[model samples]
Structure formats: C-alpha cells, structure tokens
Target: MNPRNNRQVRLRSRPNGIPQAEHFEIAQVPVEPLAPGQVLVRNEWLSVEPAMRGWVNAVANYSEPVAIGAVMRAFAAGRIVESTMPEWPVGTAVTGMFGWQDFAAIEPAAIQRRIVDEDLPISTALGVLGINGITAHYGLLEVGHPRAGETVVVSTAAGAVGSCVGQIAKLRGCRTVGITGGETKRRMCIDRFGYDAAVDYKAPDFEQRLAEALPGGVDVYFDNTAGAISDAVLARLNVGARVVICGTASVANWDPPPLGPRVERHLLTRRARMQGFVIFDHPEHTPIALEDLAGWVRAGRLHYVEEVLEGIDSAPDAIAGLYRGENLGKRLIRLA
Candidate 1:
C-alpha cells in the first residue's frame, strides 16, 4: 500500500444471509485531488450498524443496495484536511455518508451534519447525537407516541437506537421494558440504560418472563428485531397499542421472506396501529431531534455506550459481530 493512498472496504460480493469477510475487499487506492466545491476528510470514526446488512443485501429496500466493487456505504465522522469550499474549511469536524474508508473526498452536499459540540467526543456525532439518537427520538415519540403511565417495550434494547428509545420513553413517564439477546445486555438494559425491566430473548422462558414483566400489557412496542421476539410482543399488545417497526435483526435474510406468525390477527384483536419508519424519510425532524437529544445529554439525563474496533480491516467482521450480539452498544470502527 502506498503512503499517499486511501484504504477502503468495498463490496466484493453480495451475501446470501449474514455477510462474511469474504464479501468485502480492502484495497488501497491513490487519493484523488479535491475538485472544486469538494472537501477531503480523514475519517476518524466509522459506524457499524445493523442497517448495513440491508444495504449490502440484493433484496429491494427503502434505499438502493451498495453495488458490487463500490465502497461500502456508512455514516462516518472525521476532520476536514483539505477543502475547496469556504464553509467547510480545513480542520472542520463533520459527519456524513463517507463510507468505510480512511480518506474521502466528498461534495459539500454530501455532508449531513457538522460536529459543533467540541465538549462532546467527536464519535458521539456518529452515535447518540447522530442517526441512532435521531432514529430513536422520532420513532418513539412521533411514531410510538407513548403517554404517561403506559408500558413501552423495545427489542434489541441494549443496542444503539433501542437503548436510546428505552431511555427516552422512561423520560415520558412510560414503564420501559427491554428485550435483549443475553444476560449481560439484559443487565445493561436495566442497570445502565434505565429500563424498568429487561428480558433475555435467548432464555428458554422468554415468553413467560416477558408476560410477567408487562403485566399491564404493552402500549407501545418498539420493534427492532422482528421475528419470534416480535411475535411474543404482538401477543401482549394492549388495545390501541402503537407498534413502531424499526429494524429486523432477528430475521437472517429477507430474500425468501422468512415466514412468521401473522400479525393481522394481533392488530385486529388489540385494535393496534403498526407503522414502519425509515429515518431518512423524515429529514424535517432532524434539527429538533438533535436539539432535544443534545439538551438531554447536557443535563446528564441521557446515557450511551460505544464499542469501537480498531483499523479499517475491522469493518467487515464488525457488521457480522453486530448481528451475532457481540456488540453491547453502538459498534464503531476507528479508521485513523
């Protein structure tokens, strides 16, 4: 690899189920000169999210899948090293869809948000203050609409977005329940994330435990892992319950459309409202969500955790690790 080169993790092939390291190729390519109105960034941190699995899949989705031989798309935070735009001068800290690369030359329009809170860690721009936080804010408050004294349940409760959803729901005076994969995450959900109750989905008595936790029934169910865990949650929905469909982590693949217990009966019997939300569709809510999230952070009311991996090579395996429940919180890769 040349010293003056950009190292990037590109999509070598589409995966059948969960993506493997073989599906990605890390290559060193020459850094191109910045064009007019473009900024060159040295990415310090790259986000590894569950959504990346969908992005690499050949199946149709809300967004276009990453083409083979293209750089794997990702949200990254970095410092501007060179710039042709006055607004994005050298040393500006910014976050955007910069992909899994050590260096990126991006147009100003591609920049999503600038990291202005110097007091906070720059990585927070990719974690709590970034898409994860924003997604939780809108999905819970706007979509789920939990009222005081209501019971709110979140799947993947120890993960990035799910953790934030539980905390925010608690602030609204809702009884928050978290469903995670293992004992450690379950404990983290209750002890660290401040969920009223935490249940392990991997446990043999998961359904019984969930029933015991939500005695009053679930008023708001934030669905992150939509499979058997969701099936159990749907069965516990209160009349007029709100189901926020977020991520589908439990299902291994979407190509063949994995069959599960039908939800129409649950919705009809409970008079529930189920809606799917893609954060990208609601750009108008970003500023307000960020403002509220930042305020909560400053007041020490909101808490977050980040599990960072070192080097660009860690990007491929990092995604696999996320699905395997290896990451306790927000999984990130430090490229610099």
Candidate 2:
C-alpha cells in the first residue's frame, strides 16, 4: 500500500550563489487521491544536474525560474502505481519533471518519456539514457560537428555529460582532450573515459598544461563550464573550429548575462563558429537521441557511472555538491 503522506523538499528561498541545504525545507503533506487523467508515481531516483542551478536562481535562463514555495523541479524515474488513464497502465515505468518528492500525483502530459529499456537499470532513465547522455550526443555531433582525426576538447571532462562527450568524440575517430578539476578527475578522464589527454584546471600551471595537451589545437570544443578556463581554450582554437556552449557552470550569478567574451576575437581570427545548445529547444529530436544512447549502452561501447546519495534528505545540498565537483559521475537521490 502507498504511504499516507508525500514527503517533499520544497524551495524556501532563492540563493545568491550555490544553493545550500538550508535553502530548502522538508515537509510531509497528506497524499491526495488520484484525480481524472492523473497517475500516482512513486518516484525512485531524483536526478541531480548542474543545469538545476539555473532553475533555482533568480536568473532568466532557458526555462522560467522555479517559483518560490513550490516543489523543487527535478527529473525523476519511477513506476506508475495508480492511473486513471488507460494509456498509462499501472506498473508502467516513467520519467519526467516529477519534482523532488517521493510520491507524485500528475497528469499524463507530465510524463516526458516512459522508461523503455527493460535490460538497463531504471536509474539510467535519469542519467545515461536521460538528460546528460542526450545532451552530450546532440551537443557534440549535431552542434560541434566533430570530424575524424580532429582534436576535440571537453570541459568538466570527468563529470556525467563531459565523460559521455569524450567517449563519443573518441568513437567518432577524433583525438579527445579533457579539461577537469583535479588530479583524481584528470586521471579518470584519461584512464576511464578514453580521452587522449586530460588537464586539471585547478593546477597552478593550468594554461601551460592545457596548451601542451592540445599541440594540434582544438578543432571542436564542447564547453560545459564557461569562464577563465574557456578563455584559455578559445585562444588555442584551430581555423574553422566549432565551439558548442552547453552550460555556464562556473558563473554563479546571471542577474545580467556576461557579455563581450574574449573568445570573439579568437573566433574572428580563426574563422571559427560558436553556438549555444539547449536540449529542450529540440524536443522533436529527443527520441532519436535516446534511441542512439540506448543502443550504445547495450552494445558495451558506452559506459556511465552513478553517484547516488541515499534518501530524500540529500536533495537539499545536492545542487551545491554538483557545482563543487563532489560527484565523479551522474548524481542521483535514491528514494527507498
């Protein structure tokens, strides 16, 4: 039987910088009965993403700010326990913006995509087969347009999306370089993710090391963190280079968008092309991306890791931890 109440992590206030556990409050409200066209989903895994930082902030980003005092918006994987709609039968697994709650009473439209690969773990729907994987695929191939024998550089290289990007770039016959935080993640980028070279941005000689790693210059750059690190990579771009801006993780505040990047002069000099990519803008192509990601996983060519924090209580500090590079892989909150 379902629990009597739904325990949730609700947003209490917006943060000026990285959101902390103190910004949220955990509360239990009685679960409402399922209404017409609604399904009761017992959310099992809550995805923790860097993009979530934009969600809670006062910034006007790709999506509207998650309202104050509302349930924290999140992508979660779960099973449908009770459904009023025949199309979504009970026992069906689903994933979508199910919020940071254990039980969700939501309409059919609330389900973004159903969990389809029975062989893969359900948690993957919120990780490898979910946002991170899809983002990596589209951002690299479609936007960056990496070619064989070219050098492809990725920022946040050992993290979920960057890791996937490095591996995919390698499979496409490109020489891959990873730019990450520390020695530990640097090693993981090379030893685990199959990058040709990995550079630690936190190192005192970061620029020198990064230049050494890219002797041929960057042909395609998949940038996840846009700050000083990106500025260094921009200077080393080969002619006709392509840069795909996937996220701006290093910037904490976007009250006014950062402008006049030093990279523009480099772009003009090298005849390079740079563009921003947000997956939500291409909903028509999401299914195709998912199908390819699943195929890669099943064939053993693609590898992904999960850094799962036990229990709903972990949701509060999760976004802050993500920005800190505390997670080595895709982070998730396991609700049991």
Backbone N/Cα/C clashes per model: 0, 0
* Candidate 1 wrongly placed segments (more than 4 Å): 1-3
Give the top-scoring candidate (lDDT): 1
lDDT of 2 by residue, 1-336 (tens): 248789999999988767888889898998998889899999999999898888888875789988888999999999999989899999999999999999999998989888889789999998789989989989999999999999999999988999999999998999999999989999999888889999999999999999899988989999998988899999999999999999989887766667646766898999999999899887777788888889988998888888989999889999999987899889999999
| CA lDDT, every model vs. true structure | 0.93, 0.91
Where's the lowest-lDDT run of ten residues in candidate 2?
254-263
TM-score of each: 0.98, 0.97
Instruction: Please report how far candidate 1 places residue 101 from its true position, in Å.
Output: 0.3
Q: What is the lDDT, from 0 to 100, of the residue 191 in candidate 1?
A: 91
- Best-fitting candidate, scored by TM-score: 1
lDDT of the structure predicted as candidate 2 = 0.91
